[model samples]
Target: MPPIHLLDLSFQETAEAIAAFVVETDEGPVLVETGPHSTWPHLEGALHKLGYRPEDVRQVLLTHIHLDHAGAAWAFAKKGAVIHVHPVGAPHLAHPDKLLHSARRIYQDQMDTLWGQMEPIAESQLHTPADGEEIEIGGVVFRALYTPGHATHHIAWQVGADVFTGDVGGVRIPGGVVMPPCPPPDIHIEHWLESIARIKQAGAERLWLTHFGPVDEPVPHLDALAARLLDWANWMRPWFESGTPPEEVTPRFQQYVQEQLRSEGITDPQVLQRYELANPAWMSVWGLMRYWKKKLARG
Candidate 1:
């Protein structure tokens, strides 16, 4: 296996909160994730340490269109890099106005401070690969696996015997348990389970997580994530049916999740904050509630 170096974007100055990976290949170096625009300086600094400038990167493979993962991709594309992403996500990256507007509605005043600026990448720079398609850069072969459920446009890039599981792999730091990041408008429980199965069937020896880093024990880590996804969604089902408002439910869910982390012996508040930064409690509340509502409405 070729070397895959991890770059901690230190999102909001929190280490292990977000990560980007650079892989060496015959063509030079390629990026896996870009963290977000707010951490562009950190990314640039990280690249500098690796003895390469951002402009030297020729290709970037994104797991999804989420701002925290792919927001800074345009910066690289500006320097003549090919941006590879899900077909459903390509249009959003090319024309980010709608995505920005939707995000602003949620983030409000914190938008600029939290995410920084997002600029559009030209359509020609975007390459939307089909599921199971393999794209070779330099000497590395990346096989795209359409692993949705976290987002309708999510992909897990499989390289050799390792797979970059993105957010679908769950958020976990050193000494912390795997917990799902269930952000709203696209949190389908059934589909997420199927995607977990898809990952398991891939038979990768290692799973790379964008929230933090790599898990050498792929099967157990994925199993834990799948179980927690169900646990969190089931916990929200009754709350959604009983007409519990988000404002009322968010804090309670946060406390419940905190207890689970505590039981896992993750006692440090700073470490707990990192988990929150990676996967917020309130977002999971909204996401799981939305999932139940959509399912019940269809039934």
Candidate 2:
């Protein structure tokens, strides 16, 4: 049997929408990510169409507690889905005040429209996966790779040749091209590369992205992604070193990034927009620059 089933959350065409994966295990069905709560009905509908009731989904595996990935987790946990997330992320999911506040800072009034309500998970249901740990649910093995660069709490799930890379491998758009999602507060170039190496070491033949579906050619996609990440880091380092105003730096970075995408064969502007929506180019500029500043300050 296939290890997992793709639940098309119908958010793909909708604005601010994303995909979610459901892994059917021997014990029960395990959902890899819970999109925002507003999409909960759609998710439930998808699950039902797949022939399983909500309770049949006994466990929810989160690559991280980012709202898009884990927002609807609370709704499931309320229905008795055991929540699994990173240790660092467990607290935030258990008490969503910080998560909400941080998202509010970034998204402001668009919160409800962009990402639905984030409900709190009960402490008892929260399972903080350790690095290199293998979890077997109903005989299906899922090894958690502590891939932190997208976020300090991020994890990538591996099951045979298919690995569910949350944001660690970046977002693979409709055409299957990979792009880095260097969002703020937790984007570190060193750690992001390390995470990529970790995923490669795990030996997944295909990478399943949370933003969409399976990527068959892992090597070239990953190669392109790595080069772009480095290029972005290198491009932003000088700006940070020069202490350019954040206002001036962001727009400059976007142009450079857009040009890089064009060089890499992404010809369509709307395709670029999708990439921007999934992992805003501006955030990459901010995240790397901020990381550089923090690293320098520490020294």
TM per candidate: 0.99, 0.93
Candidate 2 per-residue C-alpha lDDT over 180-241 given as tens digits, one digit per residue, 9 for 90 to 100: 87778888888888888888888879988877677887877778779878877888888999
User: RMSD to native for every prediction?
Assistant: 0.7, 1.9
For residue 234, give model 2's deviation from the true position in Å. 0.8
Question: Candidate 2 clashing pairs?
Answer: 27-138
User: How many clashes in candidate 1?
Assistant: 1
TM-score of 1: 0.99
**Which number leads on lDDT?**
1
lDDT (C-alpha) at residue 146 in model 2? 92
lDDT of 1 by residue, 157-222 (tens): 999988998898889987789999999889988888899999889988998899889999988988
> Residue 109's C-alpha lDDT in candidate 2?
92
